[model samples]
Target chain A: MQLITVAGPPSSGKTSVILKLIEAMQIAASDVGVVKFDCLTSFDHLRYEERGIRVETGFSGKLCPDHFFVSNIEAAVEWGQNAGFKYLITESAGLCNRCSPYIHGIMAICVIDNLAGINTPRKIGPMLKMADIVVVTKGDIVSQAEREVFAFNIRQVNTAVQVIFVNGINGQGATILASHAAKARSIQTLRDLKLRFTTPAAVCSYCTGEIRIGNEYQMGTMKRMEFKKP
Target chain B: MNDTDILYMVLTVPVGEIMEKHPVCQNFFKNLRIEDIERGLPLHQALEKADPETLSEFGLDRHAIQREFCDFLNVFAGRSDATGPEITSITIIGGHGKAGDPENCQITINRGETISIVGPTGSGKSRLLADIECLANCDTPTGRKVLIDEQNLDDERRIELQGRLVAQLSQNMNFVIDLTVNDFLKMHAGSRHSINIDDTVERCFVCANSLAGEAFGLDTRLTQLSGGQSRALMIADTAFMSTSPIVLIDEIENAGIDRRQAIELLASRDKIVFISTHDPLLALGANRRLIIKNGRISRVITTSEEEKACLSEIERLDARLFQIRKKLRNGEIISRNALG
Candidate 1:
């Protein structure tokens, strides 16, 4: 089964896009499955269930959902395969701005809202730069000029990626998104699946639950941010 | 000779000083100038240079003394090791928590009982865990007083007890120490006074790998471990090596490890396990659950038989999820057959 990872910041219409894509894919008579990964709790799995598609949900609790999603993507694929699905779509709760859940050989889609500031695309880490497709949502809320600027900003970060302006609610651009997911390749081995970007170095003592505040006890790859004197 | 004997001897007096103070060994030291004796030679080395015949004449075997002295120095040079305490019960008395109602809350937890604390975000669940951890007595922000066995715990006693009272396994488990996995486990085992450090460390690694989604080698550096691997290691270590009777976990269900087995492993060890969670599977797994609303203990409910029945269904769903998770990690496709 082909795998498609849909990732973006919270409320970037990831589920809406997936739902519309699933509806479009059903029109073509292709079987689909979904796995939703979230940090706390989620209701997206219910939407897939309502559509009568095979679906599973995982809550990462206090852990990083992106890492959790990557670790469990295989099982999701197997579940889809057992049901004879042609495509398996996975959605990750992109809590960490720097984390990239996309894997090589899969159709990695990064959805961004036009209202999330034009600089958001630039601020996004490998998740945006490495994505095969960048879907700009909430175009209805922004003007034509603002939408163009948002798309332009995304291009500045990833010149090679295909940028699509999608209205997730009305099913606009869902056909193209569905076609890309349908044609995506499945990775044969995890070794073949490479990350497009490097992970941010873990340097915070708080990362290890170290409550003490001081540079002497701080360890790992740490960077100090200097404040400008006013 | 035993380690304690060596410790006693070295700590009591220097070997050169001991020899000098004793009249019986004065002649033996005569061959060595007073200046040489006065110049501090390590006790073990000073004993090494003494003549065997002379030592024998004084009713002391030179080789035996040298071996004993070496053993003593080894013990002296090694880091100190300690064991955890045997905690029977924990009691929490009411104080005004940051978010919880100011009403005093009174609750007591006993050994071998698993309790889950559930609340919305910023509901003071962690504050309660912290109160239990610190054995607090009105000093913390929550104003919650913790008692070990119906009596208020002394702050000094809490400091002296080490990991005997609580061993916390928080959400983030990053290993800052730059050591091999085997070396890290070995060090932990050594500190716990394991009889066979190597064997214990091996057991820990095996147990950790069983819980972790990915299998890691003993040669892997601690710093290189992923979030799931580190959590698995910490769980295994806490279950086997840690002497802490009460295990406070912020959340174990998040990192893609086998959460069910991790909880079962800790619970089976007769520990008082308290987990703060948002998942129903983990919440219902506990014998009792403390519902935290606005930071106070709004209500405590025992797991009803109906809930226990629901747990079986939840377990089935959780098991299916776990199977899919495992297959996914192995680079397998999710087929309909995988649901079975």
Candidate 2:
């Protein structure tokens, strides 16, 4: 099955983009399954179910949703295959800006809204940088000039990635996305698919449930943030 | 020569050479005794007759000194220096919370009870967990007051006994350290003053494997571990090694480990468990569920027997999903019939 990972910041229209793509794929006679990964609770699965699509939801309560998604990805793929689906689409919880849920040899899409800000592309970590396609959502709300500038900022960070402007509410540009996903080459050898970007190094003591605050007892990969004097 | 000359020569001779030259000298060196060529008593008897002060000056108490050294070594190796506090319960008083409505709420959680907080995103479910972690006394944004055994805990004591009072497991379980799994556990075990470090490390491994889908060896670097494995390791370490009386879990549903087993492990240890989650399985698993809205506690619902019964159905569905996931990871094609 063709696996597509949809990731972006919260309320960046990831779900809307996926929904529109699913609709377009359905019209083209493609069977698809969805796995929604959220940090706490999610109602996205219900929407998929209402459409009579096979869907499963995972809540990564105290765990990073990306990590949770990777752990259960195989199970999701199996579920998709069991249902004879042509595509398996996953929606990740956009909690950690630094984390990238994309895997190698898969169609990785990162959705961002024009309203998020033009510089959002620069601020977003690897999720936007490593995506194969950057889908600009809420394009209908922004002026053509604003859309151009947002697209330009995205290209500045990732020169090779394809940028697609989509209005998920009315299914604009979804046909192109669905066709690209449906016709994309399947991964030749899934044996050693690695993530496109390295996960941000986990150096903070908080990462390990450490409660003490001090430099002496701290151990691990640590980063210090510096504030410039105004 | 006189007897004094003989005595002086015996005392001046190096002990090693003297023992080698005169095998009898090995036992008789306690004090100098002139050889009476023909009438001298045996060396052993001669040493017995020597003065105690002379023996002491000759450094003949080597055996006693060696014994003391061994005793000191034992003391150094056998003692456990680590200690932790034993808390019985955690009580939340009717302090005003900083969420949807500014209302006072009170809840007392005893050891071995599991409580879950549920709310929409940005609704303050996490705020309550934070208040408890900080041992708030209406001073923080949430205006929640936390007590240990129905007594207010001071800030100094809280700082002094941070990890002992509560161990929080947040959503991120990333390891920044480059050490191997074996080294990481060893460091934790040493800090905790574990009596049997090797045994504790082994137990942690077994427990982590039980919760994680994939098995990782002790030699695997912490950075190389998958997300689920890291979470599993932390959970096992907290449940088994940490002496904390309360465990605050941000969410474990997406951690890729066995969420149910992890919860059961912590609760079985008599820890007062507070989990903030949006998952139904976790919410229903708790004895009581606190609903959070806007940033305050709106209602508290005790899990009904009907919900408990529904949990089994949920578990079954979860297991089915897990099985399918496993098969897919193994590079097998899934068929509709396989789901059955």
Candidate 3:
């Protein structure tokens, strides 16, 4: 039930970071699952067919984005893990940083495109402060001085957070960022361990329509549960 | 368990493309307070940006909206609900270039109900069903007004509500993909929102096969199903919906199912059920019967001594007419019963 959410501004390499992570995981023989909590994008579900990823876009008449992302991201992560994915990468909607790191205890990676300049950090100050990893994407587009200043300012807001440059085209600096992310813990996964509804009557805390009253393994480890009860 | 959803298993469909293909869906969006395409909101954020003021202003009721939307979608391929009808009105602005008798017509089944809409072929019986489903799903008459319990349904919410509150069973029950009986039930159950799966599955088995889950041995595709089995399967699917309160059934008699069993199922429920048929058995069983003649609800009989007598006489005349038509087709001369 661990969820690692990838957050960033639109067109700033958030999708790229997740795709690369998935590729590296597959290359390393690790099964990874990915889901997108999109706010402004729409497409056919089959686009994810090649990778075996399942997408569940938020429907109209449901709640707002902030609430949907946190809840839906949690559901997707749980579903993937149950399906035996070794890791789960969630791509968050751009322009919605208020609830970016708000997911209860997952490592949040904020992609800051260096080519976009220093103002990028200022526009996303709150997200950077909450991020566990601040990736300076499009590193080739920025001067070394600009990278240093960017990291320096980012480190000031969250001194313990890791900052690195990523040249997605050449695979430069991605290894370091990936390694840091690998060690980060997921709060949802940790909290999930405390669940002890020893009976068949124990409804899932995440999705109430499904209840776990006994020891059984479903196709997707996570039981198919509906949020809206009949 | 939340890990899988986080991994972004996407179920995205091009909203604009689908909306374009099914313009009536745009009406569903309009009902949600977004009338113009310029709002250009993506499907994921449609509910978020839905104008609350517009929904209220339109005076749309929530339950009806949910039911009608679900009803419309149930008409698609592999999505029949067979549960019965939910619509109150299906007003065609102009008949498909056929000379029009009525501009708008309403077909409704009220609460505590059993009812049927009866008509001759080309009398708009099937057309009425299709139009009702189109209106429910926001599919036809692009941007037209089709009300459920009198509240207007727009396209966005209509699609959202379609599966949850209304289910339909079309006449031509055919499938391209072969599936076992259980597979058919399971696929449909997954799409709906609120039913206890185990309980619903159990009930479905009982109704479908007239036996419990383990005892029901038949498991085959639509092509293999006898008229009775196919009709029963559809009925089970519709009756099982925890979402649709209004079930629209189009000519249950066409499948050669046991009419008594179907009637019993509808009679047992409190929800509205509308069935369109030519069978006298179904027509007489209805709580209300609307005789659609020449594409209009020419007469409605809820219950009066004279109305009851008139219906019985009409049924008699209908049976005689059917025999006469059959004999004439065979080139036989008219009999005394035919003349009467």
Candidate 4:
């Protein structure tokens, strides 16, 4: 089954775009499978199941959802393959800005809305830098100039990627996005695959079940930024 | 290179010849302002004739300059002591079990072969590894004798081979030093006399990221790396920079890195790799596996072609279980089809 990873910041309409993409896929919807990965809680899978679309949700409570997603992604794809799916869509939480979930030799799309600010394209990490296609969502709420500027910002960071204005509300560009995702190469296994970029180093005391909230409470691979003397 | 080689060059080798062979040393000398003055003079002779005022300005005397030059080149120059030994094979002469019943097993593993030690918890799996690590000569509690080249390693040979010839990748790896990943790799590459530190560092970084579940930036502090990240980093470092011909890895199932790829990467590097693991993939992956019972080498089993044929089937089951485990961790409800 061909695999596609969708990542962006929280509340960036990733679920909307995915649902719209599946809607545009039409007959391919029955053969498509999706796994929603979120940090704390996710209720988006219910929407997919309602449309008779195969879906599952994974909640990474304390760890970064992207890390959880990548670590278990191969298994998710294996499940999709076993279920006889044609496409397996993995939607990442992208809670941590630096955590990139894209893998090499796979079709990966970044869902960024025009309302997240034009500078967000450059501010985002490799999630935007290494994407195969940048789907600009929420273009309905912004002016044409803002849409042009957002596309320009995306180009500033990644010039080669195809930027599509996918309005998640009415599914305006979902067909184009779905065709791009459909053109992805069929992945037999993720065993030899490579992540396009590295996720952030994590697992502090809190990650290992630390409950307290203080400097003394913090432990385990903590990052302390070093600043030069003024 | 070793200290003796560098010292020999500094003492007698002509400046022009040294510069031609090691252009890096020229940069070091130029940066330190320790010029090899005469066109035909050796480093020592030129340093002796340096102006006293110039030497003091750089905060050094003739003796210190000569000494500093050796130390600088020692870290930056290529390794010349890497010709210590060509370890073709490692033989483990078995020892007694917990009951001291004179356990008898003689196993000889050749270079580029992978071996795994398997047994129950506290079955002396690690003890057998420790004997190999220290190259035991019936000296340890297990009374196991580990031989290099089928011959017992003497004290002098052991001392010469201690840290440089054997690399032990133990469980519970964490970086204590606070340095960037790039700097850490650079330090290792510098001491190893890597042809290109930048290229080596990049390769190590990419390899580590591939092995690790999570990727870390080159500038990421060593201390901030997760358990998996640090272990993957070390695996990559050992694979690329280590000159050690023999590698001993403790149980690596819980390291969060890809165990199969880790084994493959190390074994492909032309090293005799010995791993102690409880995981079936690792045990079956090895060319031969040692069965430990009650702190003794109970049996030695060479993996047959038939056993090797079952690996792919096992991999399929492993992938299935892997997905189930992911679902279990995600608090998702399992349907009947999850097993399929």
Candidate 5:
């Protein structure tokens, strides 16, 4: 089962988009699983239905939603895989992205409200970097040029990423968004790449040198020629 | 490369030259801005004997060596930044030395993750660690307070902080409540900062052929447990249950239960764990070590990056001590064969 997380700032229409996506998948003859992490209220199935989707909630803990949420997501995905479902969508609680563990083996989609550029970096930069794709919701509110600039800024932080502009309320670009998530064979590649990029450079054992490139012997001076590329 | 190449490298290469030349060998010497190799050659020659990698079969490349040095320096930098009493210098106002002087003694704890305060009877190792602990608690005569991440803890918060934030496992391994194994874990699971008790408890018996809950009955009481069993339970509780950022352990093998459990515990994680002990096995488990003489911390010796760098030395000494100790305990079972 492929796990897809719909994460975004508060009131970014994550729940609305998730329901719309779930409804679209069900209509397309694909069984889907959904899990909403309620950090405040205990998990309630009735509350989930009231919010407009079939789900299980009420897992209690002090841990950030991402930590425990991922576990619950994995368990739900296992069930979905056994039940022959095509996808499982997890809607996370709105919080700063740094507290959460980067989910491995799953696609991360950051849903943003298109009308605002001020909240772009502050609310979304770190989370967008974690995402394989950025979904700009409320596409009808923002002009075509504004959407292009938002996508461009996201590309500056993360060079290679797919950005989908969708209006989930009216079902505009909803099929395209689901298609991109379905095509995300494995998100582990992006996660692993980020780890290598963030980790500090390895220090040289001899002479306590911080060698960035070339072989150790040939690192600094012209005399030494042999240096291994890491 | 194979074992023979590794062996040849160790036998043929001078430690200092290897240390200097191996890590981007050309760049290292080049960055020094030296015209002649002979000018800065002495330091490498002196370090020739100190080359950490000895086995030729290991085939550790220059990159690995450089990585280790960086890790070593980073550990030191972390210790300095934390600047807890365990790594700091301490002064004992009065403690008589058997071989030497008697008053105003200073010792520097300068190695590994632990600062083992050791000396003969009345040598005041306990007094030193106690003073450091007290200092860590902000109990100095100058009324200085210890703040973790700039948050000042009051008396009640300090006690709570001491129990939950900083776990201190003294020589006495006694629990007041006669709690069942499951009940004890359940209680601690609440107190734990962020460690998943379910994951850790399950991890303990992951290797067992049988189920953890079934193999080790959850109803087992603390008092009914054997020395090794109690040590394992407590170690698991301390390491997994408590969320204490800093762990202060006094003489882990003081009563000599099963030290392998404690050794394994120390080997994991990047937490600020400080243990005081004369046991070489426990001391050697540290990444950064400190030698505490009298009330002052003396030399700090940080181990190199090789996994189990201090293992051989500690293991050799421990083996000798264990042999001598084996005579005292009549047919003592060191390792317990269990399903749990």
Candidate 6:
């Protein structure tokens, strides 16, 4: 099955872009399935089910969404294969901008809206840096000059990646994104696959449910801010 | 043969032989409403033999008609690429957008055509022109490749080819050279090895003056030319002196030149003209217009015959505006009725 992963900040139109891509692909609902990974509650699977497409939604709850995504993505791939899906898509809301759930050989997309300021491409961290394609959403809402400037900023962060403009509301550029996404090399399993970037690290005292907010409570993998001397 | 020889031959030869040899000349004849040339009569004789009523009906003089026919031949021959490899079309391969998205657009512009690039400000119109100007082979930031004759040129070939293919008149054009206009034209004509230097100089000078708002003497320094004057000067220079086959003009609408004639002059000389314009007249007048969005060509619209039919009305309106501009320059007060 072709593996496609969509990662972006919240409300950047990742789910909408995925929906448009699925529609543009014109595949049978039974042949494709989506695995939605978000932080808290997500009703996106209902949207997918409403379209008669199979979808599995997993919430990380208090855990980092991307960490949960990386850990269970293999199972998601296995589920998709058992379901006889020709295309398997996984989406992660890269909440912290610290991680993106991309595999070594899969089609990775980072969706960011034009409303996210001109410097957003650089601020999004590896989520923008490691993707094979960066789809800019909400192009219809901005001026042509603003769009050009936004695209220029993305080029500054990652020079090798392809930049595309998509209007998620009307699904204007979905077919093009789908065609690029369809070119993902098929993989039988994610067991031997490697992550494009290591997921956000750190197992601090908060991990063990310490609930303390003191510097003394701060533990593993923590960096303290250094104030200039008075 | 050179243009003069061809012109002489066409004028001296029988109209039947000229038509049979160059079938394309039929278009010129048809446009001028010159029908029913006798089998034995030459083109000069055919026009002379025609009644004055027919010539006046088409609003064409005999000598001007012959010159126009020659101009048509020159443009037709340029499209045929009589000299070397045929650059029949300009193909722009898909390139990524600014946001690292793949721009899945393939645009091919044929020779002897006028195209307009239109979009809102900061839409990368100039950037697209730059891509074509450099003949980018995925090395530019946009990763757009411009192909000539549908083949991508390597870096070495692009470097070697250089400015031989495209002569672009950018928005901010300043001539820093210290030479007089007469000296500059003579120098260019000298470099191009023109057979009739005086004739070319006169043609270029008159063409520039006709296009510009105010006329400047040939002895005027190049740096002393105004924005409109310099723009007009380059338009004339690009038409007469520049050897490049492709021409790119950025924002010519505000250049204060005779827009239609400027385009026609270049196009008639076998130059492929691409103008980045915001004016509806220039855009609609083009054979095709590319809509640029977010630094990529979002769409290409070929000017339909129906769209072309609207141009005459636009041209008329533009002419009215031109008159008002003239009156305003003469310090005439703007009366309410004069707005029409």
CAPRI-style quality class for the chain A–B interface of candidate 2: incorrect
Residue-level lDDT tens digits of model 1 in B1-340: 3666555555456656655433223322332222244325545556566555444432346454445344423432232334447567888888874554584568888887889999997888876875676566565556677788787556467544422366667674445546788877775564344567788788889999999988899999977888898888888888877767888888767787888788888888878899999888889989899988877888889999999999999989888988898788789999998887
lDDT of 2 at A50: 73
Residue-wise lDDT of candidate 2 within B1-340, one digit each (tens)?
2444434434454434434543323212221222222124323333444455433432234343223222322222233434446677787764554433565578888999999999988887765765675566665555667788778777566544432366667664345546788887876665455778899899988999999999999999877988899889888888777767788888778777899889999999787889999778888999999888767787889999999999999988888888888899999899997777
List per-model TM-scores for chain B. Answer: 0.74, 0.73, 0.53, 0.77, 0.48, 0.70
Q: What is the C-alpha lDDT of each candidate?
A: 0.70, 0.69, 0.52, 0.75, 0.48, 0.76
The candidate with the higher lDDT, 2 or 6, is 6
Winner of 1 and 3 under TM-score: 1
lDDT of 6 by residue, B1-340 (tens): 5688779877788877877766545645554446575647777777778767556533357786677567655655324322323468888887987787788889777777898999988888877876776566675567888888788676567644543466667555555445688987775564344557789888999999999988899999877988788888878877886667788887778777788889888888877889999888889988889888888888889999988999998988888788788889999987777766
Per residue, candidate 4 scores C-alpha lDDT tens digits across B1-340 of: 6888888888888777877776556644554445556637787777767667656644457786667667656644544422325788888888799998888999898878899989898898766765665566675667778788888776678644543456657664445546788887776565444667799899989999999877799999877988888889888877776777788787777777887898889888887888988888888999999998999988899998988899878878887887787688689999989999
The digit string of per-residue lDDT tens for model 3 on A1-230 reads 34576767767877666655554333332365667666655452354445566555553123345456544554676677676766677766544433343443567788877766543464454466567778777754432223444554454344456676655654444444555556657443443432111111222342333355544522233434458876
Clashing pairs in 4: B1-B78, B1-B79, B1-B80
Better-scoring candidate (TM-score), 1 or 4: 4
TM-score-best of 2 and 3: 2
Local error of candidate 2 at B229, Å?
1.0
Poorly placed runs, candidate 2 (over 4 Å): A1-230, B1-83, B97-100, B154-159
Candidate 4, residue A197: Cα displacement in angstroms equals: 52
Model 2 TM-score on a 0 to 1 scale: 0.46
Arranged by lDDT, best first: 6, 4, 1, 2, 3, 5
lDDT of 5 by residue, A1-230 (tens): 56677677667777767765654343332466566666666433564467444565534244455556544655665555666656667676645544332464467777777655522633343466557777777755432223434554554334445666555665444544554565544321222222211211223333244445556444422333468998
Candidate 1 second chain TM: 0.74
Docking tier of model 6: it is incorrect
In terms of lDDT, the poorest run of 10 residues in model 6 chain B is B77-86
